[model samples]
Target: MRYALYFSPAETNPLTKAATQWLGRDAFTGETFPTPEADGLARDTIHELTADPRRYGFHATLKAPFELHPDQTEAQLVAAVERFAADTPAFDIPNVIVGQLGRFFALVPDTVYPDLQHFAARVVEEFESFRAPLSDADIARRKPETMSATHRANLDRWGYPYVMDEFRFHMTLTGQVPSEYAPAMREELDRRFSEFANAPLTIDGLALFIETERGAPFTVHRWLPLAPVSENRKIAS
Candidate 1:
């Protein structure tokens, strides 16, 4: 199984409910939801547009998926995640908006947030030990020849090309959309996620997601809140 480190809101968070509904699958619950209706898009088209993100569920990739290192065990990785979460303090993004990345759509921060970048980098660095070296197939799949020198270097060193300076935090919402359908898709996504548009998104926790096999949907193995016991109690109180 491949494991990924992702940023997802607490299960009770309103954004979690909204995002799961929008994506049509809840990673935490292993439950499927009906896709929201859109005026111009057929239900099948909607499903097709969402197929990729739905499989991954609703979350931002902090550390991309990788198999465990030969020296490591799953239990050790879980313990590390718990320790990391306990020590890390929570923060928030100033604002998030629906934006298109190439042909895909995602929730992206309106402004660059240094704290967010730092947090993601930290996760990648801290978890490097748990990641196995990329196989020949994995390297070929990334197309290192087409990538810039720095990205190729990153891929060799980190096992994933998008890390450190290359990372852009985005919670994907849909797969590649045809140019003809782009405008309408954006409008519908804006409507469906209107309540969260331009809203501050708290970075309160990270989740562990497991893919049972290649091309399988990931499921949430655990949700680790990034707050101390006392602070969490204070917030609850």
Candidate 2:
């Protein structure tokens, strides 16, 4: 079973209910309990992804999926995550939007936020000690021949191609929207998210997600609050 630590807003906030409805038992929707839409654009963007619940849903990835290291156990991984969460205080992400990134659709951060990206990188880096190096087959499957050298390098080092330089913080809403609906879909998403068209989105915590087998859906294992901690009060530093 592969496990990933994630950050899920639906688990804590009421504004994500509509998104949970759209996702049903897949992806982000299943892990997060039902909630209402925080912003109109969030509703529309999530709705489009849920249009095909079997495939898409809304949620951000803190740790990309990976198996436990040969010497590592699940309990150890969980403990590591807990420690990491404890050390890192929570922070907010400013206004998000339903934007088009190339040919795909996703909810993106409109502002240039270094903390969000840094947090993601920290997750991947901190937990790396617990991660097993990807097998050749795993690498092959994750990295296609069409991938560029830069992306391939990212894959070899980080186990994912779109990290660091290529990373754009987004919670994917759909795979590939059929061309015919592209225009109208974009319009609807834009109109719907207009309420939060520029509203700040707070990232208050972290979530742990699990997939036990090949055909299983991810479920939430833990939710850690990202709060401030006074360094001076540390037990040992």
Candidate 3:
């Protein structure tokens, strides 16, 4: 199995519920939800648009998926994740918007937040020891030749092309939409996610997701909250 560190809101969070419904699958429950009707789009069209994101579920990736290092045990990795979550304090993104990334659509921050970047980078760096180096097959799958020199270098060193400076936090909502379908998809997304637009999104926790096989749907193994260490100290005192 391959493991990924992802930022997932609490299961009860409205955004989480809406996203899962939009994609027609719940990562937490491993259950399929019916796709909500969109006025201008056919149900099949919406399903096709969301096919990719549905497989991965609703979350922003922090540390891209990897097999654990030979020296590391899954138990150790889980403990490390729990420890990291307990020590880290939560923060919020001032605003989020439904935006298109190339042909795909996602929820993206309206502006770059330094704290968000720092947090993502920290996740990548702190977990490097637990990541097994990417296999040659994995490297080829990324199509490094099409990537820029810097991205190729990042893949070599970080095992994923987008990390550190290259990372742009996005919670993907759909796969590539044809140009003709893009406008309708955007409108539907805006209507469905309107409450979240310009709203503060709390970065409260991280989740561990596992894919049992190469093409299997990823499921949440655990969700850990980011409780401030100072809060624990205060309670103890």
Candidate 4:
């Protein structure tokens, strides 16, 4: 199995509910929702566009997926996640909006925030001990030749091309959307996620997601809030 660290709101968060409906899957429950109603868009097309993110579920990746190192154990990783969540305080991204990343649609910060950057970088650095080296197939799958020099270096050292300076925080909503469909998708996503558009998004928790095997859907293994346990909302593990 592979594991990923992500930033996901509590299961009850409005953003989580809306995104779950749009993607048609809840990472927390292993449940599938009906494809959200999108006027003028075919349900089949909506399904096709959202297929990728649905499999992964709703999350803003903090640390990309990795297998445990030979020297590490799942128990150790869980402990580390809990400690980190307890010690690190919660923060917010000033404003977020529906934006396109290359050909895909996602919720992205209006501007790069320093605190978010530092927090994401730390997650990468802190978990270095738990990440096994990338296998040849994994490396090839990242398409290093198409990446920038900096990205290639990061892939070589960190096992993920997007980390530290290369990270662009986004919660992916759909896969590659043809240029012709961009305008409609943007409008539809804006309607679906309007409450969060140009609004602050709290960085409240660190979620550990588990992928049972290659190509399997990921599910929430744990949701640990950044606040101390006694003060935070009751959340499931």
Candidate 5:
């Protein structure tokens, strides 16, 4: 089993509901959904495009999946997360927009937000001790040869190429959309996520997601909300 630290809104949140419908699966409930209707896209095409994100569920990955370090226990990690959540103040990203990362798509902040970057960095650093080093197979899967020197170095050090300075926060919405499909996919995504895109997204909680085995759909193991700013300040004082 492997675990990932991710940011996901509560299951009942309207944003979550819309993303869940668009992606056709609920990471929190393990339920499958029919592909949402789109004017120019067939259900099969929509499902094909979403296959990758569907397995992972709807989330912005903070820490990529990793096995526990030999000396660490899951209970210890959970306790650490609880304590971390209790002390960190919640914040928000002012606007989110549908943006493509290479050929695939995701919801990204319209502008950089330092608090979001710092929060993500903190998660990576805070949980580093719990992450086992990447095995040769895992490293190979990341294809170090194609990575730039910095990304390769980061993969070597963090077990993920996109952490720290390399991280660009994104909640992946699809697998690679073929060049032919990109325009329509973008249009459909905009239509489907209009209520969420270009609106503030609260960074309220950390979700612990687990994969029971390779290729299995991941599911939320816990949803830990960050304490309010006032509460955190009081605790600190």
Candidate 6:
């Protein structure tokens, strides 16, 4: 089975709920939102511009989508993920606020924390062997023109472009907005998130989402809290 590790905003967070409604269709259910008519309209507008139905919805990818090695057992993968979480202590995410990443909107950190950056980097580096190499066709579809030299190199090497320095954690709210609609989208997102923006959000938990194939929305399989590692425990690969 293929899996992607992502950082998702807590469902209980009001801002997240608001944004979730605005997205209209839950990528998870593929069902359209019934209430909040304005939210549906905004979502439709954003989705039209993006024109990529498959990329919609929320969640921030820490490790890009990858298929696990067929030979590896699920038990082995779960054990590895648990080991990584245990060794890494949970750290606070400071200044989490809604912001635009190009045309799409997301909740991003105010400043890059060394611990989080290092942790993400380690995930990319250590679990890389589990990933199938990106095919030339997939690379071509990525379009080098849309990315920087560094990002292109990352894609070629890591099978994902947004890792290491290019990484910015974001829970995607929309696909991409047209220039004409950018102002309106930004306004709506800011207004929707304003209530929660005043305070800090702590990220103390790690979750595992399992998916079987392409075009599937992963369900949360495990939510593990990051705890202090014992000095005597040696982490095995």
Model 1 over residues 157-181: C-alpha lDDT tens digits? 9998889999999999999999988
User: What are the per-residue Cα lDDT tens digits for candidate 2 across 46-140?
Assistant: 45554543332346776777777889998888787778777887666777888767767667888668888898888878888877888889887
Between prediction 1 and prediction 2, which has the larger lDDT?
Answer: 1
My TM-score estimates for the predictions, one after another, are: 0.94, 0.79, 0.95, 0.95, 0.96, 0.79
User: Candidate 2 — worst ten consecutive residues by lDDT sum?
Assistant: 32-41
After superposition, the stretches of candidate 1 with alpha carbons farther than 4 Å from their true spots are 228-237
Question: C-alpha displacement of 225 in model 5, angstroms?
Answer: 0.6
Off by over 4 Å in 2: 26-57, 191-197, 229-237
Instruction: State the lDDT of candidate 6 residue by residue for 1-237, as single tens digits.
Output: 567666554455565466556655444444566434344345445546433323434566778777777677667777877887777765566677877778776677877877678878887887777777777787898997798899989999998888999888776665677677777767776777787564576555555666666666565555556774455542530
Q: lDDT scores for all predictions?
A: 0.92, 0.66, 0.92, 0.92, 0.92, 0.67
lDDT winner between candidates 3 and 5: 3
lDDT digits (tens) for residues 31-107 of candidate 4: 99887778767889999999999999899998999999999999999999999999988878989999988999999
Steric clash count of candidate 4: 0
Q: Which consecutive 10 residues in model 5 have the weakest lDDT in total?
A: 228-237
Better of 4 and 5 by TM-score: 5
Error of 1 at 37 (Å): 1.4
Worst 10 residues of 4 by lDDT: 228-237
lDDT of 5 by residue, 65-156 (tens): 99999999999999999999999888889889999989989999997788788999999999999999989999998889999999998898
lDDT accuracy of residue 131 in candidate 2: 73
Clashing pairs in 6: none
